[model samples]
Target: MFKEVLQQLGVKQNQSSAYHPQSQGALERFHQTLKSLLRAYCVELKGDWEEGLPWLMLAAREVVQDSLGFSPNQLVFGHKVRGPLALLHDGLKEVSDPPQGLLQYVEGFRRRLFLAGQMAKENLLNKQKKMKRLFDRNTESRVFCPGDQVLALLPLPTSPFCAKFLGPYTVVRQVSEQNYLISTPERKRHSQLCHVNLLKPFYSRFSESEKAPAAVAIASSVTEMAEDVKVPEDGILQPRLNNSETLKKLDEFVKHLPFKQRDELSSLISDFPMLFSDSPSRTNVIEHDIDVGDAKPIRQHFYRVSLEKQRHLESEIKYMIENNIAKPSFSSWASPCLLVGKPDGTYRFCTDYRKLNNITKPDSFPLPRMEDCVDAVGSALYVSKFDLLKGYWQVPLTTRAQEIASFITPSGLYSYSVMSFG
Candidate 1:
């Protein structure tokens, strides 16, 4: 049925033998990227990987392939996708509407795709040749007889201390050129046939008197078995600053600050001593007012919590109270808090404001366009960028707004004194 479907599409299926993932080069490469992206997202979001799937797909298509010199999206569309940067630079003009007439558009698109395919194919061939040259540079070639002793490297657990390449397993027979069937000591067939790259010739100088485990003759490092893992010519690894070194640099930087600026910075530290705490800054609070107007207060019950998370939530509430960021409340409005994992491996306390936002009137104030802001900096001799620390919490909220933003917790009901992240 699969072959029939391919025939219908005027394409012939080229099937290779199973169990050799390296043969499907493109798919294997994509799988590597997919795994890496998913792992990163899962780590950052604490297993909320589903939320990152769309981003993963977008990132994959936008990334330029090393061999093709073009992103998957670009090759298919015959142009790069208009991302945020592009849209910011050129406004709506960055993504113009397609040609009106369907037939004419199809012909144009077809021509563009054909040209792109030709270019991609040529580029891929050149890249393959270059890669092959580099690969052969340090690769040691060795042929084995039918009964030769060899060790086959197999996939193992992903631990730094775990052995990556294992086996003093015997070579069963030569399946094809540079390919061999391997087996155990009892002559049982191995899991799969291995390529020449996976097999290292096992040389025995002494008489066959020594008996060792399969992992005994394994390579010390990946570089010993693979040509790609080469050390730098300088042989010196880059120096990473220790904690003390980092502190010393910061102290040195502080020493260079102007007297007036130092005084101003010191004033902020003195005024907002509690700002160093995890809770909101007490200096200037921004109360979030739910202008329910005539609508009734929307109160939500506290959600079920895990023991570990409940403890964290309690600790976070205490931290906020100690810093004067939050206080006990009897407000009619209430919301739930979600514990999200931050990149730093700490949990960020987030409130679910969806219920409130749904009934609230949308703010229509337009933000300045990125293009205009960037253009305003034209031909400047020197430019400076400043990031406000805890900018949202710096704005104080009204007393009424605080009550409207109350949330229920395991310990008790509480409300923010300053603006909170939702």
Candidate 2:
């Protein structure tokens, strides 16, 4: 029934020979690694491997393969999946800012899947060539042509005491570099595809006059013994942070807290390192858009600026373009730019959008009063205030709004890739 289902699904089943475990290169390597892991766990913990199986599997997924250039978990999840140990080292530095919205996650998943598939296909092709080289290097080479007779070691595990190596089968064909199809005349249905390791060439001891026509002819190729099994790599089971380093770092982190509450607060923050950030995060939780609503293009001429301000505006424009906050525009709408000086001696490149604002249709929906908002949050156990950083720029503008939000400058006409302050 399973075979029929597979056939209907356009899948071919390729089964290896029974009880001869050689030349299954990738599969054998995985099994060897799993066994090594289980054995080590048993030795260290003095317990059965069943309790540690889940952790062992997760460890395997976290290991990066040289051929794939990614861990199995990263290829599957399409994001950084840090185990607990990662927090000790990675959190001490910086957390990458990637998780902003659902769209980024979806795109990353698709990209990782595509890269993994391409990498796996290339790796398989190269592995075949590498295996052929390794096989040819350290062993005697033997090739069996068609029409050769062979004695195959076909084991019957159900009846262990029985003489299982009873095959005197004729060679059908060579399926691959080290695989073959062999069958006997009496039992044609018992034909099996086998590795070259399971076969041996048959020899005849009779003279020409006394010889019978029924001697076995075995065709064995020595190449089926695959490359040597690789030992599992040594790695830290669990990372440890020395007391001196932890205390020094912890002291710096909790220095501002009250002396009595430092220990408790430090523990709380340390327990959840992912929730804290050293700097303001630019998040895209709210997608703000400008709605001009069929207003005519407001084309204002460029404003005059001093040569010094012009140079600053040019540098600012270059920076915004490089960082993807703004882009060059060919829109029909534009407004004059302004240079507002900051108290810290730097000038802010501002846009004058009075004409654009005058033409735009207003949304006049009434907002809830402050008293009503405060009433709605009555009896709350906790209240937290978050001040968004570069809040206007964090939200993305709609495509149509972007054209309407364009501004004129000494350099050229440009549009905001993100929402911009007027």
Candidate 3:
């Protein structure tokens, strides 16, 4: 099939066999001889092997060949090779004898070839040096200051080589001006203080307001009870608004609220806002009371509903909570149950033993003997298949292990109430 495909792609039978060593001995032998000459030339010149490739090719072309009865150059150009002095003498003779323009043309061709070879050598050396520098400087280090945030580059857990920069950590401690201790809440271990060159400052929405001022001025001071401006702490800076200014802002926030709610909000601000003298107040609270005149709250007796209907509702709620199928919050007391509907449109409930089964501990579990399994499968033709439907949901999780088993989805962090494993 592969041969047919290659033939269809325009690969001739002889060309296809060219890759085999036995079929291309002559070409392979030539390549070996060319490589040997290149190595010898590079060693003598104290240069890279790659630097001698073109020169080796030129030398090979000009060298006499036993098979061809002349140099490869002569075979191609239909002429005999000559030294520089011989060519020069020939050119003078040509000027006198006036034999076509061949001698002058050969001199111009030699000059062009020499110039091109020189340029190629310089370009190759420059490119090699650039590539070597890149490989030499593989790892980079960075630093950060106290309170500064930085992203930490880390490897992916599944494929460490395929890892990438994974974090935006906060620099909680500055060990030195050039090194800082970064903090990442999601990471299991704390990262070491890194050098300044590798650390880049994290730009956040609040960074602009956090910049230090050029000069200490009263305009940037915080206001106290007597309208007296206080200088900010050494590393700490105040926002544009002062305490009295913030109080006025708070008053403005509650202005649209009901009179009673506004008074309550003002009282809470007067107490809490006084403690944080430098902190800016950006939050507001509003409340409204609804009037339900002549309306009474509904009350139901448990005995009023049919036993089957009550069971049905409980089962539905249990299923909703177990599978995280509903957005409604479930109480901790909710239990797992099964629902059964009757022909009369009523439903019954059956309590599930899954909750109790979860609490029971496993006494003994066997470990996988991977080596033995591999040995048994050796030299055998076998098909491998995988099942992914309810892949994680099918596994049973212990009650004590459920907390760690909880995972975050688009909806929220949820612990499976039923057996689930991966």
**Model 1: per-residue Cα lDDT over 1-422, one tens digit each:** 98899889999765544435666778888988898999998988887777888877876787778898778887978766765434554684556665579788788778877887888898999999998899889978789887777876665545534434566777778888867877754333344577787778776776555554445554333323345345535554545444345434543456668988867766776685554433334452233455666667889988789999999999889977887778999888999887888765668787888888888777777999999988999778888986444566566668877987788887889998877778
lDDT by candidate, in order shown: 0.73, 0.74, 0.53
Count of clashing residue pairs in every prediction: 7, 4, 8
Model 2: per-residue lDDT, tens digit, 1-422? 99999999999876665555564556788889999999999999999899998888877777876655677777777655776445554778777665567887788778878887788668767877787898878777556667787787765546655535555678889998888888765553567877787778866566666775657786553432346422223422333334445555786556667987997877786787544442223456655567777667889899888898899989988977877788999999998888887665667677898888787777798988999978877878887787554567667777888888898897799998787767
What are the clashing pairs of model 1?
285-395, 285-396, 285-397, 286-395, 286-396, 286-397, 287-397
lDDT of 3 by residue, 1-422 (tens): 98999889987764422112534655777888897898788779989888767767876776655443345565445444564434666888885443658788788667655554555456567765776698659855454556666765555667766635656778788765545667866766665555454457666765554676667756433445254434444535543455567677786556668999988978886777544454212222321122223333222112223565555555654554655533342223223333455565544433333433454444455887999888877878985755333333334444433433333322233444434322
In model 2, what is the error at residue 208, expressed in angstroms?
Answer: 2.5
Off by over 4 Å in 1: 1-47, 74-103, 155-169, 185-192, 207-422
RMSD of each: 24.3, 39.9, 29.1
Q: How close to the true structure is residue 412 of candidate 2, measured as C-alpha lDDT?
A: 93
Query: Cα lDDT for residue 350, model 1?
Result: 78
Alpha-carbon deviation at 168 in model 1, angstroms: 4.5
List runs of model 3 lying over 4 Å from the truth: 1-13, 16-19, 81-422
Top-down TM-score ranking: 2, 1, 3
Cα TM-score of candidate 1: 0.39
